[model samples]
Target chain A: MTIKNRSRITVFILSFLVWLALTHIGDIQEVIAGLIVAFIVSMIAGKFLITTEKSEHIVKRFFSAIIYLFKFLWEMVKANFHVAYIVLNPNLPIKPGIVKIKTDLTKDSAITVLTNSITLTPGTLTVDVNPETKEIYIHWIDVLSTDVEENTKLIGGRFEKLLTEVFE
Target chain B: MIRVIGMAFILIGITFDFFGVLGLVRLPDVYNRLQAATKCVTFGSAGILFGVFILQGFNNFGFKALIGIAFIFLTSPVSAHAIARASHRSGIPLTKETVVDQYQEDNELKDN
Candidate 1:
């Protein structure tokens, strides 16, 4: 099958799975309806759903994505505490600033995930992305370090690492 | 026991939401407020839904709660990013205490 056809099949299966999750397999009627809806949805929106070409290691990517989700949740919890501490402190101790960091990941989707992860994590919010240079500008609540490499490690390093495994 | 734990989670979620609102009122600038409010509230809501998941336990209601958690996680940051970008681009200046303004510098470089 051509890549386009393969992507449509992938979208179809995904939408059907989402349907199952939503309905929880109520009855044979629900299953039949889900199949039809998923088929129509895939045929209409399949191409837009997945931007990248098929990766060779689908199993590896799937596992990596699951691991990434758990890690992301943990990071998010820690981030709340960190923000809470800042909010509660009388001095408020925040040295907010915009800093630049670069990423090597080329795919649009990969870069997007990296950006979203940074925004949700501790003391950082993504402000702008330079498409030409692959550099991301972040508004950091606490300016821990001025050095680009140090700040990059402090902010985007961990997410970028796992994201590379899943997306690259 | 599970229901008790679920109640605890919901309480924690409410506490986080309170802090998020506190941060919204206390922080200095738009960006700072967005930082506190978005993170805490997103996690707060997710915590509440997760507690529902625990209370319901794999039934239809519980599964939908899990899906809601995923939806919140995926979408909140994107909206936060959009607001921050628009605020910065529209000449919303950072606070005096802000240490750096690299985005402004980059804009200047591009203009020149």
Candidate 2:
């Protein structure tokens, strides 16, 4: 099947499933209505819903994405505790600053996921992204290191690695 | 047994939230406060939603709770990014303790 048709079908199925979950399949009439609505929605939105080129390794990507989610949760919980500790400390020993890091991920979506991951993890928050140069500017709570390569490894390494697997 | 586990999850969530609010109050600058509050609170809310899912099981309410968690995870960081970028562009100064300003330097270099 053409990629466009595949995406339309995918959208239709997803929207219908969402409708079922929302309405709880109250009756046959509801199911019929959901199908009709999902069809309309997919016709309108299918092209825009997916931007990445169609991949042959969809199943591999899917499993990696799930693994990435669990790892992300683990990282988030650890970081939250660390930030909490810093907040509760009376001295507030934070050396906040914006630092630049380089990224190799070319896909916009991949870059976005990486930026958000950095923002939510540890003491880093993404302040700006230079798409042209593939550099991300992050406001770090503690100025642990100034070297760009070290900061990239410290902040974006794990996420970038996993995202490249999933998105590349 | 499940209910008890769910309660534990909720308790942990509330603790995270309390710390998040405290961070909001104590942090030194706009960027710092955003970092503290957004990260802590987003995960705290996710914890609470997961607890709800645990308590509700695989029914409609549980699925909705899971969806809510997904939505929060996706959107919270985007909003935080937007706010941080806007404040930086609007010339909101970082706290006096900030050690570097690469974003400002980059912009200055661009203009020159």
Candidate 3:
């Protein structure tokens, strides 16, 4: 089969799985309805839904992405606690500033994941992306360091490595 | 035991949300407020939903709660990013304590 056909099928399967998980209906009619809906929706939107070029080791990448998700969640929990600590403190110690950092990931999906992960974490917000230069401007509450290399390693180090593993 | 655990989760979630509100009111600017709002709502609501899931067990209610958690996880940051970018571009200056303004420098370079 062509790559396009494969992607369409993949989208259909994914949407159908989502439908199943969301509805959780055992009725035959509901399941049939879900299948038809998922197929039609996938046919209409599949091409736009997936942007990543097809690569080898699809199964391995998929599993690794799941592991990456758990790691991301752990980071998120830690971030929440950190923010809570700062907010609850009497001094409200924050040194808000915007800092520039570089990202090497070229794929749109990888860059997106990196930014979203940063935004979701506590005390940091992704303000803008220089698409041409692949530089991200982040608003950091703590302003740990002003140096680009230090901030890059501090902000994007862990998540970037895992995302590259998943997407690249 | 299950009830106790669920109630504990709910209480903790409420506390986090309260702190989030406090931060929102106390923070100096839009960006900081967005940070407080997004992280707090995401974690707080997710925590509450989790508590509901635990309280409901693996039934329909529990499953729906899980879906709610997933939706919040996916969408909160995107919305926060959108608000932050919009405010920044529309000329929301950083607080006086801001140490660096790289975004402004980048814009100036582009303009030149």
Task: For candidate 2, give the DockQ.
Answer: 0.83
Sorted by DockQ (best first), the order is 2, 1, 3
What is the per-residue lDDT of model 1 for residues B1-112, given as tens digits with 9 covering 90 to 100? 9989999999999999999999999999999999998899999998899999999999999999999988898899999999999999999989989999888988999899
- For candidate 3, write residues B37-102 as lDDT tens digits: 888878888999999999999988888889889889878888888888898899988889888888
> lDDT per residue, candidate 3, A38-132, as tens digits?
89988898776565556788888898899988988888887788788878888989999999999999988788889989988867988888889
Better of 2 and 3 by lDDT: 2
Q: On a 0 to 100 scale, what is the lDDT of residue A113 in model 3? A: 84
Leading candidate by DockQ:
2
Interface RMSD values, listed in order for every candidate: 1.4, 1.0, 1.6
DockQ of the candidate models in sequence: 0.76, 0.83, 0.68
Q: Which of candidates 1 and 2 reaches a greater DockQ?
A: 2
Candidate 1 chain B least-lDDT 10 residues: B67-76
TM-scores, one per candidate: 0.90, 0.92, 0.89
Which residue ranges in model 2 land beyond 4 Å of their true spot? A27-45
Ranking by TM-score: 2, 1, 3
- Alpha-carbon RMSD to native, per candidate: 2.2, 2.0, 2.3
* Chain B TM-score of every predicted model: 0.96, 0.97, 0.96
Clashing pairs in 2: none
DockQ of 1: 0.76
Better of 2 and 3 by DockQ: 2
